[model samples]
Target chain A: MWTWFYQLASPKWFYQFSNKLLPWFRAATFILFAAGLALGLLFSPLDYQQGNTVRILYIHVPAAFLSMFVYVLMALSGGIGFIWRIKMAHIVSVSCAPIGAIFTLLALITGAIWGKPTWGTYWVWDARLTSFLILLFLYLGFMALHNAFDDRKTADRAAAILALVGLVNIPIIHFSVEWWNSLHQGATISKFEKPSMDADMLKALLTMIVAFQVYFVTVLLQRVKAEILLREKLSGWVKKLVTNQ
Target chain B: MYFQSFKEFIEMGGHGFYVWLCYGVVLSGLVSYFIYSKQLAKRNQRNLIKFYKRMDARSQLNANNQLNANNEAQ
Candidate 1:
C-alpha cells in the first residue's frame, strides 16, 4: 500500500495512470451530464413555489457543491504536498485552482439568476453568499501567488500554504446558512436525516453532482499531464514521450 | 414531459430566460475549459519537442566543430 502511494506520488507514474483513467472519466461525465440534464430540465416536476425558475437548481446546486468540494480537495492536496514534499501533490493542487474558480463563478452567477425571480434581487451580501465569494477570491489569490514566484518550488510552497490557510473558510461556507439568518436557504440534504427533496429531483441533483465530479477529474488529469511535461521537460521519460508524440 | 409542447418547454413556463441562461453559461464555461486544457497540453508537447530538437542540433554542431579542429591538428 505504501509502495502504491509512493508510485502515485511519482509524476511519471501519475501521468501514465491518468492517461488510462481519463477516457473512462470522460465517458462517465458525458453520460451522467446528459441524463442529469434530461431529468432535471424536462422530467422532474417544477417546484410548487418557484415553478420553472427552480430549474436553475440543477446547475446551481452542483456548481455550488463542487466549488466547496474542489476547495477542500485543493487544501488537502496542498497539505499533502507540504508535509510529504511530493511534487505530484503540488501539481494536483495547482491544477485544481482554475477548475475550482470556474465552478465558484458558475455558482455565483447561477445563484444570482435564481435569486432574481425568487428573492427579487441578483446580489446579496449574506453569510453564505459572502463566504462563497471569498472562496472564489482565495482560489484566484492562490493562482496569482503561484505565478508570482519565479522559482517553481517556492511558488508551490507559497501557494500550498495559502491553500491551507484558506481551509478555514470552507467550513464557514458550508455552515453559513445554519449559523446565520441569511436569505440563502438551509441544506436540503442532511447527513443525519432524509433529504427534503422529491425522489426524481434528488436523483437529478445527485447525477449532476457525479457528472461534475467526474468532469473535474478528467480535466485535472489533463492539466496535471501538461504541468508534468512542462516541469519535467528535460527528464529522460518526458523527452522520450514528447519525441514519440 | 412536464411541458405541454416544445414551445412550453422552450418558454419554461415564462422563466425560460433565467433557466436557459444559467445552463448555457455553465456549459460554455465547462466546454471552454476542456478545450483550453487540451490545447495547453498540445502546446506543452510541441514546446518540449522543439526544445529537444534545438538542443540536439546545437550538440551536433559542437561535435562537428570538434571534429574539424581534430582534423586540423592531425
Candidate 2:
C-alpha cells in the first residue's frame, strides 16, 4: 500500500496513470451532464412555490457544492504536499486553484441569478452568501500568492500555507445557513436520511454533482500533466517524450 | 416532457431568461476551460519539442567544432 502511495506520488507514474483514467472520466462527465440537464430541465416536476425558476437549482446547487468541495480538495492536497514533500501533491494543489476558482465564480453568479426571482434581489450580505464570496477570494489569493514568488518551491509552500489557512472558511460556508438567519435555504439534498427534495429532482441534482466531480478530475489531470511536463522538462522521461513528439 | 410544447420549454413558463442564462453561462465556462487547458497542453508540448531540438542542434555543432580542432591537431 505504501509502495502504491509512493508510486502515485511520482509525477511520471501519475502522468501515465491519469492518461489511462482521463478518457473514462471524460465519457462519464459527458453522459452525466447530458442526463442531468435533460432530467432537471424537462423531466423533473416544477416546484409548487418557485416554478420554473427552480430549474436554476440544477446548476446552482452543483456549482456551489463543487466550490466548497474543490476547496477542501485543494487544502488537503496542500497539506499532504507540505507534510510529505511530494512534488506531485504540490502540483495537484496548484492545479486545483484555477478550476476551483471557476466553480466558485459560477456558484456566485448562479446563486445571484437564482436569488433575483426568489429573494427579489441579486445581492445579499447574508452569512451563506458572504462566506461563499470569501471562499472565492481565498481561491484567488492562493493563485496570486503562488505566482508571487520567484522560486517554484517557495511559491508552492506559500500557496499551500494559504490554502490550509483558508480551510476554516469551508466549514463556515457549509454551516452558514444553519448558524444564521440567512435568506439562503438550508440543507436539502445533503440530508442522507430524509432529503427534502422530490425523487426525480434529487436524482437530477445528484447526477449533476457527479458530472461536475468527474469534470473536475478530467481537467485536473490535464492541468497536472502540463505542469509535470513543464517542471520536469529536462528529466529523462519528459525529454525522451518531447523528443519523440 | 414537462413542458407541453417546444415553445413552453423555451419559455420555461416565463422564467426562461433566468434558467437559460444560468445554464448557458455555466456550460460556456466549463467548455471554455476544457478547451483552454487542452490548448495550453498542446502549446507546451510543441514548445518542449522545439526546445529539445534546439539543444540537440547546439550540441551537434559543438561536437563538430571539437572534431575539427582534433583534426587540426592531428
Candidate 3:
C-alpha cells in the first residue's frame, strides 16, 4: 500500500499517467456538458410559474453541490498529504483551491440570480447561502495561507491544516435548509426519497453534475501537472525530459 | 430549438440579462483556463529549451578552452 502510494506521489509517474488520461476527461467533459445543456434548455418542460428562469437550476444546483464536494476532496487530499508527506497529494490539494473557489462563487452568483426571480430578492441571510459564503471565504483563506510562507513545505502544511479544519462546514452547508427555516428551497433531489422533480429536469441536472465532475478532474489534473513539473525541475529525469522535448 | 431567435435567446424571457451574464461568465472562465494552460505549456517549453541551450553552450565553451590549453602545452 505504501509503495503504491509512493508511486502515485512520484512526479514522473503522475506526469506520464496524466498525459494519457487528459484526453478522456476532455472528451467526457465536452460531451456530457453539451448533453446537459441541450436537455435542460430544449427537452425539459418549462416550470408552471418560474418558466425559463428555472433552467438556471441545471447550472446552479450542480455547481453548488460540486463546490462543497470539491472542498471535501481538497481537505481529504490535504489530510493525506499531511499524514504521509506525499508531494502529489499536496499539489492536488493546493491546486484544487482556486478552482473550488471559482465554483463556489458561481454557485452563489447563480443562486442569487435564481433567488431574485423566485424569492423576489437577490440577497438574503439564509442559512444555506450564508454557509456557502463561508465556504468561499475558507477557500480564499486556504489560498492565502499557502502563498504566505516562503518555504513550499511549510506553506503546504499550513494550508493543509486549514483545509482539514474547514471540512466541518461541509455538512453544515448541506443540512442548513433542514436545520433552519430558511428562504432557500428544500432539495429537489435527495437519497431518502425519490426526486421531487420532472424526469427530464432530473436527467438534465444529473448530466450537468457529471459534467462538472469531469471538468473538475480535468482542471485539477492540469494544475497538478504544472506543480509537479515545477517541484521536480531539478531531477535528472526532468533534465532529460526537457532536453528531449 | 428552445428560443425562437438568437435575439430571443438573448432576451431569455426578460431575464435575459441575468441568464446571459451567467452564461457569459461561465464561458469566459472556461476559455481563459484553456488559454492560460496552453500559454503555460508553451512558456515552460520555451524556458526549458533556453536552459538546455545555455547549458550546452557553456559546456562547449569549456571544452574548447580545455583544447586550447592542451594545444599550448603540446
Task: Count clashing residue pairs in model 2.
Answer: 0
Regions of candidate 3 where Cα sits further than 4 Å from its true position: A1-6, B1-10, B48-74
CAPRI category for model 3? acceptable
Error of 2 at A56 (Å): 0.8
Task: Tell me the TM-score for chain B of model 2.
Answer: 0.71
Winner on TM-score (1 vs 3) = 1
Docking level for model 1: medium
Pick by lDDT: 1 or 3, better one: 1
Model 3, C-alpha of A192: deviation from truth (Å) = 2.2
Candidate 1: the clashing residue pairs are none
* Candidate 1, position A18, lDDT: 89
In order of TM-score, best first, we have 1, 2, 3
Pairs clashing in candidate 2? none
- Please give the distance, in angstroms, between residue B14's alpha carbon in candidate 2 and its true position after superposition: 0.8
lDDT of 1 by residue, A79-185 (tens): 89989899999999999999999999999999999999899999989999999999999999999999999999999999999999999999898899989999999
DockQ of each: 0.75, 0.70, 0.33
lDDT of 3 by residue, B1-74 (tens): 56667787667688877766776676577657755664564577667778778888999999999999999999
Strongest candidate by DockQ = 1
